[model samples]
Target: MLPQAAQLLNKIIKLDFQPDIVTYGAIFKGLCRIGDNASALTLLTKMHSAAHCKPNLVIYNTIIDSLCKDSLLQQAMDLFSAIKTDGIQPDVVTYNTLIRGFYNSGCREEAKGVLTEMLKSNITPDVTTFSILVDMFCKDGNVKEAQATLQLMTRKGVTPNIFTYNALLDGYCLRGQMEDAEKLLDIMTQNGCEPNVVMALLEDMEDKGIRPDIVTYNILMDSLCEAGQLEDAAKFFSDLVLKGLQPSLKTYNILVKGFCKKGLMNEADDVLRKMEKDGCLSEDIFLVMTFPRHYTTAIL
Candidate 1:
């Protein structure tokens, strides 16, 4: 279907019918899905030259996503530079893509720099911006940076939501700072913010006032166990029970794995048994049960 679409695009190009930004973005996105990033990048250049039409934020985002997936982090940044040189002002999506791209490419400083640039451009950072930055900083063993970004969010009047807390908690847990993560959870509750950052950001602006969400509880619960903080994990689970939110099977599996990591077979067994009793053990979890010293040591 993509090849046919590309052929159709080429035919359109030949007859002097310039495809709109959407058309180019569709073809560019298709190329990304098929793992032909190099061709996609080249085609992007071709589109620029042939039509002299600047690609929109969507097309740039597609290319940046493809670049990040292809491990071309530097190239992605280079394109970010080109985006401006080519007279394209990046939107919020572009900033998130570049921030994540720099993050995945092991360019932490540059990634943070992109965030600063976004601020200078007056492009308001969204939850995704803070979430990805938190994840990147935390994964890179920069827990303080993660915390600092949260502070920045506060100064900017972007209240920390669950994703913000979950991300910070995850970072703390990853760095063996379970106590700090728990403290963050406490702060989240005290601040009257929801647990998940994504929903928190949306609910504030979503015309309809549906504020009920469960993603933050799930992330924090899962992250706790994944980081081997079983006691805290269980505490969060208990909290979930109190809140009347049914713990999904995925949640139970996370606790079990956490117990298993701490070599507490008894606790793991008990958690699994309870999950079965609750009739929530039907789903499969891709549990990375093998505890590694570090999931990534590439963070510079």
Candidate 2:
């Protein structure tokens, strides 16, 4: 695509059609897409030499984003500093892109430093900004920090969305803080985040009028199984059907494993049959077959 674009640009130049920054930017973007940031930088230098096309903020931001995506953080930061040196003001996209790059590269401190710089510049952090922070903290198992970030987001008048709430919920769930996770569900409702949960948690769900999606049910079922509550997990499986939700392949696998854990060969076989009837293939067939046939026949 880059070669074809370059050929067309040369033809256009021969016809005396002057290519502007936007025209050059389009081709530079294609080079970045192919993971050729080095070539893209060379093109930028060419644009500098060619008087007809001057690099603009969009051009710089595109290269910066591409550099960050390629995990060249020092190069990205160098370009970021150069942007200011060149007298083009950095915008929210520039800051957000760098912050994301740092977070993805596990450079959390640098990412937060970028956020602080953005704040000092009086650039209000957007939902995407807070979402990234929340996700990063949660993934790092810093639930307390994630919760603090969530509070900061609300205090700054940035309403949390489903993704934001979900991140916090996931953080709580990861730490086995079911009580906190349940409370977050209410906060999610109060904040007008869309509903997207567990048993007794299901009772809490009913009490709170929260609807359980398939993911919610799956999480609860998995948690229950992990807690060795196979009976409760089975109930969630039944409730899922009664609620008109189809059990996912994951749902079947969880149930099979839960029953197998309890040496309930009959129940495991039943679920395997149900999974097959549902047109789902069980990846745990070896576990299923490994269970002694004599044990299954005895249970039958």
Candidate 3:
């Protein structure tokens, strides 16, 4: 659709109308969207050579982001240098694109090197830079490194947000290190960061006038179920309805499975009946509850 728009724009331009850099940039963006960076680069060249049109920061940034996403880091770097030579300084977005690309390529040091370059170039590392590093490190199972990066961000005067804390929390949880996860939660509370799980963070959210959503309720319910606290799960499930949030099918299934796991067949049947009454029952739930022994113990 965008390419066709570009063709129409060209037709309009030929009818005694002139298209400016923004107009050409839009077309360049459309070309890049179709995974035609080669053509986008060619268009950039033509724009640069044209007497009336020249590429701007947005155009350069778009191409650089596209190149990095495509794993053409060398090409992206070359374009980065070219953009700098054209008197357009690379912004944080440019560095971020390169950092993500290098990290994805397993070039950890190279990825960090971008941060160093940013500091040397007098560019401040924003929350996004720290968040990206923390997320990447956590995903790579380097939770300790992620924690260290979080500390670094704090020391550098960049307050850790909920996402930053959540990444570390998820890392600790993934490793089954609940002790560390709880400690991190304490730190988050101390730092006045909040997420919605009906725990301490729930109070924080309410104090800030932010109501807990369905996803928040689901997380709390699932956590309670996993911890063998079916009563707490049930209470939270009721609170979810009281809060005017619709429970998803997964929410019902979690509660039913929790009851079934504890051999409370009657309660499980009750929940199943409630699900049917809500018009949310599906065949999937029947299968999930039918073969409990196989479902619980079967290995992929």
Candidate 4:
């Protein structure tokens, strides 16, 4: 469809229709969506040569995002420079994309450099910008730096969202600093940010022969179910059973809630039946069944 659209666009142009920037922008987006950055870049070059319709910041940002996703970091950087040469100021989105691209490509220092440049340009870092920094620092096992970044974020009057806290939590969990993780979790709750189950932390615990208790399993299952990963959540239940651990009522409720949220009434029924078969049925399950469908979905 995109190829056909592109051909049609060329025909319209040949007829002297003079396609505006919006038309060209749509085409560029389509090309990039299909991971055909080559074609997008070619079209961008053509747009550069055209006198009437010069590419705007949005178009440049789109291509820059596409290039970054493809790990064409050098090309992305070159285009960043081009944005300035074209008298277009890079926005927060532009800096964020480049920072993420450089970090993803193992160029941590370069990513920091991009942030510095952004600050120098007086583009105040937003929550997303700080979140990325926190995630990057945490992933590097530099919890100290991640903590510092969090402090700086607060000083800058930016509130740390779930992603920010989750990164730090995972960092502490990875290093087996449960005390600090718990402290952070407390802070998250106080700040109205619920801590999420970090699967990587679970995997690391397993690798270290550290057994997680029922509560930990419940947290993980709840997280998975919330993410609509019903199958995975069910597998975790099975693992809980195989480990001679009892599935609490909350476990069944989580799965039922997940299935209900996805509109899979039959699957939800099967779970309820299984709960009964295991002699785990309780009034809570009845309450869950009695609740209106929308009510069940909302509680999760």
Predictions: Cα RMSD each:
16.2, 13.8, 14.3, 8.2
Q: Pick the TM-score winner.
A: 4
C-alpha local distance difference test of each model: 0.70, 0.79, 0.76, 0.83
Tens-place lDDT per residue, model 4, 190-275, is 56443243555555566766566676777777767766778888888889899898888888888887888888888888889888
lDDT tens digits, residue span 187-266, model 3: 55455443234265545545645555666566666667766789888988888898788999889978987887777767
Assess candidate 4 and give its TM-score to the true structure. Answer: 0.68
Tens digit of lDDT per residue, candidate 1, span 19-137? 88878887898989998887788778788788446677678888888888778887888888888897888989988887887777788888889889999999999878988877777
- Name the regions of candidate 1 deviating beyond 4 angstroms: 190-300
Model 4: runs farther than 4 Å from truth?
194-300
lDDT of 2 by residue, 1-300 (tens): 688887788788779788987789899889888888988887777677776768898888899999999899999999888888888888989999999999999999999999999999888898789988998999899998998988998898988776676667667766777678756765554444422233444565455455566766776676777677788788778988998999998888788777776788789889888887878875455446665564345433
> What TM-score would candidate 2 get against the native?
0.63
The regions of model 3 sitting more than 4 angstroms off are: 8-17, 189-234, 237-300
Candidate ordering by TM-score (highest first) = 4, 2, 3, 1
Of candidate 4, the 10-residue stretch with the lowest lDDT total is: 188-197
Q: How far is candidate 1 from the true structure (C-alpha RMSD, Å)?
A: 16.2
Supply the global lDDT for candidate 3. 0.76
- TM-scores of the candidates are 0.59, 0.63, 0.61, 0.68
